[model samples]
Target: MPETAVADTATGVPLKELAARHGLASSGRLLGPVEYARQLWGYRHFITAHAKAKTVSTLGTTNLGTLWQVLTPAINALVYYIIFGVIIGTGANTTNFVPYLCIGVFVFGFTQATVSQGVNSITGNLGLIRALHFPRASLPLSAALVEIRNFITAMGVLLIIVLITGEPVNLQWLLILPAMVLQAMFNMGMAMGGARLGSKMRDIKQLIPFIMRFWMYASAVLYPVTRFTDHLHGWKLHLVEANPMLVFVELYRHSLMENVTLAGSPRLLWTEAVIWAVVVCGAGFLYFWRGEKGYGRG
Candidate 1:
């Protein structure tokens, strides 16, 4: 009888109760975690197809095409070799310094590309986000996939370069598979977090490059991780060794290069890498999901 008591006129039922009974929800309602993950799984095929399409189209406009993927990192390694390896003499005592540096650059580039693209995944696809009704996580995921594809191409070239630099194709090289899988997991987490931040704060997209550059330097992409251990000791040494990107780079180097010393013990490096991947991937997914309802809104 109250003025606020709205009902389904014909059925004489409260409107809210009727909607619930019919399994209806607000347009922007947040899904429960289980249901959300289920929906995401349903779109797995779509995600892969979308990723493949983007991978091909991303470099389609360029004359060099996908060659740019390998060339970009290859060229970066060359420059770093000139500055650090030659000019600074960081490579003075290191064996296969060219291959070591290339491994670092190419491996770090995978994370850099994924996170950088993830930062724009949502903001860059505003129109698509507004027009479509799909799991928003797909954007960052697809972006990560694009980089994964590029990284694979770049990796082939990397192995060739390593061999050209006189590193043997030994049993340890097989370890790159697990190392890359861990790195990919970590990169995906970073991408999702970047997507959420970029969606909410557009300015983050501009700052990500500088952040990634700093990360690259800290990851020891140009120099050996020993550079950190040589200067810092105790907790400082431990802290630098804990860097996930550095962990991944060292993992690849250990697998590919002979007689390379890691910043930390092998067990410690692997343990930290596994921890980083699990924690970041879980946390990033939850963080992005929590903001789902707010996406595409002012």
Candidate 2:
């Protein structure tokens, strides 16, 4: 039997050879890291639009609309204040307990929501993935962006609370900008990692809430970070201080509140913040990239 080669009709060249000559790749093949990044960057507009759409639709059904973005965390902070600050008397020794807890609650809540949404980013968008050829990373990045947009509104409420609680407006408040940037980077990384895991294991989404709850306590959201100093020492103390969420929460406190002292020096906290942001974000991106080809496969 004679085999007939498949050829591009217009060029009259064999299709496989024509594709090779044009530097084409298999549709399902994984792209090189550099190429993948470039492709993802090229889709930035789509990502931003997707994020904005999701952010708007998130609270569209509610009476308050986007106001719930600020209220949700504000209410969480109020509840924690009643339970931990008043009933438990955890805030008795700390100054400016109200703003302190608000910063912790809002910041941790942002990260928790970012990661939780990231976990569903892929599974939630299977239809889009199957129908489109855009970078899959866009889904997770858009998930992070949605939270970032929500967090900005929440921050406005947080600053108002800080002012009402007697924290003076100072130049250090500007530090919140860089602190937020670092936290956003760290969060993007967490979301990418979660997206990858979620694509493979549906159960991971169900577990995220429990994990984030534990992370909230570990992050010192309802209590003073200084408590770690009283109970632990050496590597134990150092390890707890290195928790990325705690580092971010303390960074917010250091910037906004003058009365609160942190578990570590400002220099150490900033260093850890930069390190965690780079390390986690870089590692998570690579981890997710490695699974790129498998993302939409059933």
TM-score of every model versus the real structure: 0.92, 0.93
Question: Which candidate gets the maximum TM-score versus the true structure?
Answer: 2
- Model 1, 75: alpha-carbon shift in Å? 1.5
List, residue by residue over 1-298, the lDDT tens digit for candidate 2: 9999999889899998988998997887888888999999999999999998897787888888988988899999999999999999888889989999999999999999999999999999998998988889999999999999999999999999999999999899999999999999999999999999999999999999999999999999999877888899999988888899999999999999996889788999999999999999998899999998888888
Tens digit of lDDT per residue, candidate 1, span 98-170? 9988999899999999999999988888888889899999888889988988898889999999999888898
Worst 10 residues of 2 by lDDT: 55-64
The TM-score between candidate 1 and the true structure equals 0.92
